[model samples]
Target chain A: MIHRLIYPCEQAAKLSSRAMEQALTMPERVRLRLHLMMCERCTNFSRQIEFLRRASRKIPEVLENDAD
Target chain B: MAKYLGARFARCHETGITTRSISTMAEDDDLAQSLETHRKYLQRYAQFHLRDPSLAEDAVQDTLVAALSQRDRFQGRSQLRTWLTGILKHKVIDLMRSRDRALPPDAFSLDQDNNSAEGAFDAGGNWVDPPADWGKPDAALEASQFWRVYQECCQRMSRRDALVYSMREVMGLSSEEICKKIEITTTNLHVILFRARQSLRTCISKNWFGTQHD
Candidate 1:
């Protein structure tokens, strides 16, 4: 029997959506955690999402404070 | 005594955090100070969302006027900032929609080739090069400079594209809700977001990253 990936591509995309909000449903959360345990690519993608979030936050603060 | 305690607890639960109570409490505070605080944040939030300093100032003033007029309706369930931001968002949408109507047919040609949409990293998942250190003694200065460039690039985008990107990436709105608010299909939303990001990325590279020849 083929061992199906815990989170398939479409489901992984949904997981990414939840991950963007840093909120995941119980079952989806479990599946994402399980997948991340075995998948390096997904793990890297998660890190990228987090980096993007942090980087974006700086833009508004900077614009607001600019003297020029 | 136990019965009296239970009754008190039930009453406390029953009367929990009503909008009327919060509004009354808010009204009892320093109105001027509260309005000033709202103005400061609203100015910043509007600047970020609208990317036009003059427009942002106008939006902040408008938000204050509206909020003051609607003070009686403020239940205080949400933070004042959130409430003010909601007002500014609506104002921005109105502004953009009106501006869209005034544009000529060819004013917004969507044919520009956006080359930066692909991953900034290579196969090894490393940035083409680590971001350059500006060699500024003050980290804050470096950060501020980069942010100015970022803001400028974001402002260059069309209003619809910028709105989609800001709502999705910066504000963290879900795609479905963004689609509903922006009145576009999911595919169109994705394309807009992709193009917006690509434009921003290219702009940042050109302005901040310096050229390969440099």
Candidate 2:
């Protein structure tokens, strides 16, 4: 039933980024979960976003000691 | 001021600490050398965030001068670049705050075009075009080529968008702080961030990861 109530991918993507910055409402969270369950592409997109966020945090660390 | 720099150099000698009896003049030379070495990186770092070459140059030049005069305060534990960046961060914030005053009343034109995450879904809120698997992405982060392509993508974005993105992602500033620095509303910053991420994703996928990034 949850999967059947699929939220749109655009909404899912928006919620996905918002989730990084702050808490998502329960309904928002549930709908996004349902959408992700039904969509591999959204899941992939979400993971890619998380990866970028994490990588960004590491940039200074990478550049700090560079002899250049 | 030149007078202040002169005072700092004079004080360098007054320390009279036996351990550092080595000429303060020598330490001064080292600071000058290191500051010059890091100039390009510092300039690029500022330019990358400010998206204005002249302002970036101004911030970097000030940062170098400040670092030079305050050389005595630098503890040896951290890398010099890291220390310089710490100082540069403050300088950039100061420059941006002042620069905001000169901005036109309509500086941050809300780019409504990107507000809609277009083609991301259908009217019913379901995926019309879904994202593709990026495979294992960890390996790509270590690839120098990936960084080159990522920098190109950033450089290609509009000035304001690039500034907002760099402030958030590269500088790791909080969204609220970024809003205050750039003087934009939170919603506008989010839209800009989303657009930046979308463009970066497209660029990365097409150039580095796979095709169809566009």
Candidate 3:
């Protein structure tokens, strides 16, 4: 049961994206935080996805033709 | 200043000069022309929701016409893109509602390419190819070419995933609202959102960040 608190990179990545839409359970949050502490790649993945969300909100403004 | 200009404009209308009317017509033309500039962007917006190019085009046409007719209602309080996006959202929903009735039995059938990223992970749920570091991603936000690449990556997603992802991200719908709109369970919505984000992250990292990403 204690090992369940240690999420793998894939589960950590999913939890990170899920965090954007909804709150995670306490154990799930702890698991994700623990995995992220040791995983540099998943940390980058989490940050990049948050950035993706921000960039997506700007799609309307960015899609316009500036040359026009 | 606007009131004085309106009073002068009223006199111009009462005088009925050919030059004044012609100039007014020219102003209308200019407005249409400026509105025309947004057509490509509007078409892309419609396509994101409608999923069919011809239908998207029709929706954009209707939106532009409605915008032109109701141009006075646009008080410039918000960004013009925001206002136009609001109008386009309505047009997209209306089109979707109408099309739903006439859709064939297989309208929602899955695409040939599932485009699932489930294979990206190994048996132990580790990334097959771990994510690359994207330094200063905010800088890419300012580059128009980067947007083109980003949109291309979005388009590469399967239709169902794209619809769900766009509804959540681009439309800014709440998770509950997106689940209701797409008729999916919250669990299913989370899975789709996860895949969509993962796919987009890998695509953007490869195409934009990782010069050496294989």
DockQ top scorer: 3
Per-candidate local distance difference test: 0.60, 0.74, 0.76
Q: For every model shown, what is its TM-score relative to the native structure?
A: 0.57, 0.75, 0.73
lDDT of 1 by residue, B1-214 (tens): 2233345335644776354466554553444357666576667777777767887777776676677557667788787767777777777666665667688856544443332234444554343433333333223334656566767888887777787777887766778878787577765665566556545655665676553321
RMSD of 2: 4.9
Q: What is the lDDT of residue B198 in candidate 1?
A: 47
Q: List the lowest-lDDT window of 10 residues for candidate 1 chain B.
A: B131-140
Show pairs that collide, candidate 1: none
Candidate 2: tens digits of C-alpha lDDT, residues B93-180 = 7787677667885775675754655445566656554567888889877777677677787777666676677678778888898888
Clashing pairs in 2: A8-B125, A8-B126
Off by over 4 Å in 2: A1-5, A61-68, B1-30, B50-55, B69-78, B93-107, B111-114, B118-129, B211-214
B47-160, model 3: which lDDT tens digit per residue?
Answer: 766769999988887777777668788877877667788888767766776766576747544433442365878877778988878878898887777876788899787666
Tell me the DockQ of each model, to 2 decimals.
Answer: 0.10, 0.59, 0.67
lDDT of 2: 0.74
Displacement of the residue B140 alpha carbon in candidate 1, Å: 9.1
Q: For all candidates, what are the clash counts?
A: 0, 2, 0
Docking band of candidate 3: medium
